[model samples]
Target: MNVFQSLVSSWQFWAVLSALAAALTAVFAKLGVKGVPPDVATFVRTIVILVFVSSLLFVSGQFSIVRSLSRRSVGFLVLSGLATGASWICYFRALDLGKAGQVASIDKMSVVLVAIIAFLFLNERLSMLATLGVLLISAGAILVAVAD
Candidate 1:
């Protein structure tokens, strides 16, 4: 098999693993938020991620991926990681402070933000249905946020 085919074949494996990871994160955030401040919970969660990634490097024998990193790659990775950490902190804090359905619905509207940013900056085109869907998502987020 060629390289592309080999990579494509393993997508399902990665998807399942990612789903499980997301579920566990939600569970831990909910449970951990009961007593700890959101910032502290986020700090602990980030520390856990650092340890998990370190373990994966050793287990997968891909620890050398870090060695070949260029200056730009390292900068981007650190920025992306920090952005995700902030997003998760806000996400868990929102969930802790509000109804799950409301929080989730609002968060789901980030797709619209992605589309808007792409359209403006990347000059991407959106179909009619996609435009309508974005409107619907905004309305839904408003309703969900104010519902409870």
Candidate 2:
């Protein structure tokens, strides 16, 4: 396979893309919330995301599965949505008040949190090396957040 095809096929590629997009989100959101209230900015961002994702679902014919989803699936999705909304509000507010890099650094501490949470609740296994990496990520995030 060509390099581009191989790269696009890997989960690592998508994760890297997500990281880059998140980095841009911090920069763009910091700028966007300059004069606006963070909550209001979050609302606007939510609307845009809703429209964009809805359109993508519609065009991809994925909207048809909405009614086929189980009640439990819907319930968890609702909870996830609530959590996402809360996180976005807090993230935007942090961006409004702090340095983008520092805010993003702390935000990325979610990685460590997820690793622990997954191991506890999702029965995911973490080897010693992975645990050490998580510890390093936590330390790095803390150091970056506290750095002048």
Best TM-score among the predictions, by candidate number: 2
Model 1 per-residue lDDT tens digits across residues 7-46: 7789786788876766566666776788678888888878
| Clash list (residue pairs), candidate 1 | none
Task: Give the runs in model 2 whose Cα sits over 4 Å from its true position.
Answer: 1-5
Residue 65 of model 2 has an lDDT of 97
Candidate 2 lDDT score at position 100: 95
Per-model TM-score versus the true fold: 0.73, 0.94
- Each model's C-alpha lDDT? 0.81, 0.95
TM-score of 1: 0.73
Cα lDDT tens digits, model 2, 1-148, are 9999999999999999999999889999999999999999999999999999999999999998999999999999999999999999999989989999999999999999899899899999999999999999999999999999
Model 1 lDDT-worst window of ten: 19-28
